[model samples]
Target: MNLTITLVFLVLTSTVRSLNILGIFPYHGTSHFLVFRVYLRELANRGHNVTVISHFPEKNPPANYQDISLAGTIEVLKDDMPVEKSYTSIINTALFLTFTGKENCEVMVKNKQVQDLVHSKAKFDVVVVEQFNSDCAFGIAYKLKAPVVGMMSHILMPWHYQRLGIPYNTAYVPFHFLEGGTKPSLYQRVERVLFDVYFRTLYYFVTQRSDQNTLARYFDEIPPLDQLAGEMKFLLVYHNFILTGSRLFPANVIEVGGYHVSKAKPLNGTLKKFVDEAKHGVIYISFGSVISPSSLSHERVKAILEVVSELPQRFIWKWNNKTLLKAQDKLYTDSWLPQVDILGHPNTLAFFSHAGMGGTTEAIHFGVPIVAMPVLGDQPANGAAIEESGLGVQVQIRDLNKENLLAAFRKVLDVKFRERVKQVSKAWHDRPMPPLDTAIYWTEFAARHTNFTFRTAAADVPLYQHFYLDVICVFSIFVVILVGAIRLSLRVCRSKSPGKASEKKQSKKSKRA
Candidate 1:
C-alpha cells in the first residue's frame, strides 16, 4: 500500500468530521500506552493527522508519526513520564492516588513547560486524553479550541458515572462476582466504599469551592460555585469490551477495546520451537509490570517450575530480574516474551498471568484458558470474572504453591476448559470488528458529536437526592426538636401561671405604697 494513499484514506475519514487530537499519556507503560498507541496509529494510518505528546518515542509507530515531515505522523515526546519509573509496580498507585483530582487538574494549567506546548494552540477538532492525568490533560484540552474526549484504559467505563454513580478517577469499579466464583473480598469492598466516600466528599468540596480561586485571581472577588467550569466541564471516552461484563453504557461513552488487535510483531523462532516441541501444550507464566518475578518466594517459584517441569506440557516463563539466575533446560527465561505470538500458537493451551487487563484481554481473545495469580488493583475481581465465566481458575499469589499451581494448571488443560474458552473466544472474535476498530468508530462519533449523553447522572445529584437522608432524616430530626421545644415552653408557662396572680398582687401592693 502506498503510504501517501493510506494517509489520505485515514485523513479523509473526517470529511464528515476531522479531529486534530492532542493525544496524551502521562507516563509510558504497557497499560498507559499500548491501546492508545494502537488507537493513534490507526488514526494516522487512516489519513487523519495525529499529534501525539508522550514521554518517549514509540518504536515503529504506525507510519512515521515523528518523521512524517510531509503530511505524515507528528509524534512528540513530552518528557513528562520518566522512563525508569514507568515500570509496573503497585507502589506507584499510592502516588497516583495521593494527587488530589483538583490539584492534578491544576498542575497542567500551572506548569510553564506543559503550558508552552499548548502555547501554540492547534484548533484541534477533538482532544483524546487519559482521565488519570487530569492535572495536565485538561490543561492541554483547555488550550485547544476543540472539544475534549477522555479515554480510560481501565475497565471502569465513563457511563458508570450514570450507571453506577462512579466518577472519573474517583473510585474503583464495584465487582459483581460470578456464581461460585471469587468475589471481591470484604476488605476490598470496604476499601472501595471508603475511597468512594472520600471522593464523594472531595467532589462536593471541589464543586462548592471551584470558583473561589478563579474569581480571586481574575476579578479580585470570590465567585459562587456555579461559575466554576474548570473542575466541572469535560467529556469521557472509555476503552471497555463487553466481555469484561459491563452493560447499559450511555451513548456518549465509547467502548474501544482497541488494544486487542495490534500490528505488534509476532513471536520469533526460538520461542516457537519451545511451543511446537511441547507435545502436551505450553504453560506461559508472567506477572505484569509492578511485582518483580524475583519477589516470588524462591520456594514457591521453584515449586511452580518444578511441578510444571514435571507436567507433560511444555513451559515458557517470562521472568524479569533473573539476570544472575540459571534456568533448567526445560524452562525458558526472559525479561519479556512476545505474548501475542505465543497465545496464537495452537499448542499454547493456557496462560498463567497476573491478570492485568492487557494480558486478560489477550488470553480471552485467543481462547486460551487462564491460571491467574492476581496481586493488585482489580486483578482479583478480573480473575474472579474469568473463573466465574467458567473460562479459567485464579489462585491468590499467597496460595500459589506447588500443589495449587499444579491444580490450576490441570484444571485449565481439561477438555472443559478448552470448550469454555472456545465459546468466549468465538464471542470475542465474532464481534463486528476488532475491539480496536469499534473503539476508533466510537471515538470518532464522540469527537464529532459533543453532546455526551450519560446512562444516568449522579454527579449533579447530591446524597440527599440519592439516599434522601437530608430530606427525610434531617427534616424529621428538625421537626422532633421543634415539637419538643414547643412542648417544653408550654409546660414552663403552665408552671408560671400559678405564680402570675401572686406576682401581680405584689406589684399592685408596691404601686399603692
Candidate 2:
C-alpha cells in the first residue's frame, strides 16, 4: 500500500510540473537548426508541451509536440558562401547576415500561425529562441510574456561576450573566424583585437540596427533587442571547456556543448557493410550542409580523388552530386549520412571534414582524429584548434593538393596522434551530469524562477564604464600632470644652481682682493 501511494504521489508531482515551451528557430540553415531541434524534441519526450516555429518541421512528432512550419518562406543556404577569406568576402558575409536577419524577422512576425498565437490568450512558461544572426525572435518572446532562454548552436558571438560577461580577452582567446589558436604570437593577438573591434562595431551599427528596425515594424513599445537578449534567464552555449579552453562565464551562461550528440544509432545495412568490410579502416569525408561538395573546383576534386585512390583505406564521401572517381570498391558516396553512427563505429579511423562546429565536436567526442581542410567561417579557428589539441592537422584550401592531402592523412593516422585524440575524448565525456540533462534542468529552473534576475552587473554597465576607460583616462591625466610638475621643479633648481655658483665665485674674488 505504501509503494502504491508513493508511485501515485510521484506521478501527480510530475503532472503538476509539466510546462508549455515555445521554441523559435527562424534560420533556414539545416546545420544550425540540426543542433537546436534535438533539445526541442527532447522537451516533448520529457512530457513538456512544445510548440516549435521553424523552417524545417519534423515529419512526425510526439503527441505533445506541435510545429508551425516556416518552410518555403525563406531560401536555404547551400553553396552560397565562398570558401575564400578576403576583405570583400568578409563584408559580403556580414551584409548577407544583416539583411537575412531583417527578412526572417519580418516573415516570422507576419506569419499567419504566429499572428494567431500572438492574438490568442495562451500562456507559455518560457520562450526559447536561437541566438544566431537575429534578435527578432526576442520580441515575439516578449509579447508572449514568457521568460526567454537563448540557445547558441556554437560559441557565443563576438558581441555576446560583453553583454553576458563572458571573458573575451583577445590576447589568448582567439576570434571564431580567425585561424589562430589559443596561444597566439604577438602579431596574431593584435589581429584578434582589431577583428574583435571590427566585428562588434559592425554588429552594433549594421546588424543590430537592421534587426531592430524590422522588430519595430511589427511590434510596438518593444524593449531594445540587446536589452531583451541580456534579460534572458539562461543562455545555453554549445561549448565545452575541454575542447574550448577554460574561460570565465556568468552563472546564466550554461555550457551544454554535446547535448545535440545523442547516442549512436545503428547504421543502415549498406553503410554498415561498407564500414565493416574495410581492410584498413574508413576515412569519412563531409563538408557539412552549408558547403556542397559539388561546389569544389575540378582541380581540387581531382586532387582529392588522386589522394584517395592512392590510400589503402576505404572512404565514405558525403557528396550531393555524382563523382568522377572510379574506385567503386574503395569509395562510398551518399547524399545523406548517419554521421554520428559512422563516427562511433570502431572501423572508422579518421574524419576528413570542413571543421564546422557540429562535425568537429562529434570528431572529438568519438576520438576520431581529423584531417581538417578549413574553407570558411569558424572552420579556420576550429581547424587551428584541432591541430593545437593534437587531434589532427589543418590544410588550407589554397594549399590543398595531392601531396598536402596525403601528408595530412598520414599525420592524423599516426599512432601518437590517434592516442592523444582518444585521451581528449575521454576527458570530454567525464562531465558530472549529461549535457542534455543539464540543459533540461536549467530550462525548468528558469521556468520556476521566472521573476529572478540572472544577468550580471556588467550587462547593465556601459562599454566605457565596463572597461574602466574613464578611470584610465583620469589616471593618465594625473600622471601627465605629475610629470609636468616634476619637470618644472627640476628646471627651476638648475637655474638657481647656476646663479649660486656665479655668486660664490664673485664673493671669493672680492675677498681675495
Number of the top-ranking candidate, with TM-score as the measure:
2
Stretches of model 1 off by over 4 angstroms after superposition: 1-18, 59-92, 99-113, 133-135, 157-188, 198-242, 263-266, 322-328, 451-457, 469-513
Q: How close is candidate 1 to the true structure, as a TM-score?
A: 0.72
Quality of model 2 by C-alpha lDDT: 0.84
Model 2, C-alpha of 436: deviation from truth (Å): 0.7
CA lDDT of each prediction against the hidden true structure: 0.58, 0.84
lDDT of 1 by residue, 139-186 (tens): 445545456556666655222353334443222344321111224556
Give the per-residue lDDT of model 2 (tens digit) for 218-306: 66778888888888999998888887767788889999988888777778788888888898999999999888788788888899899
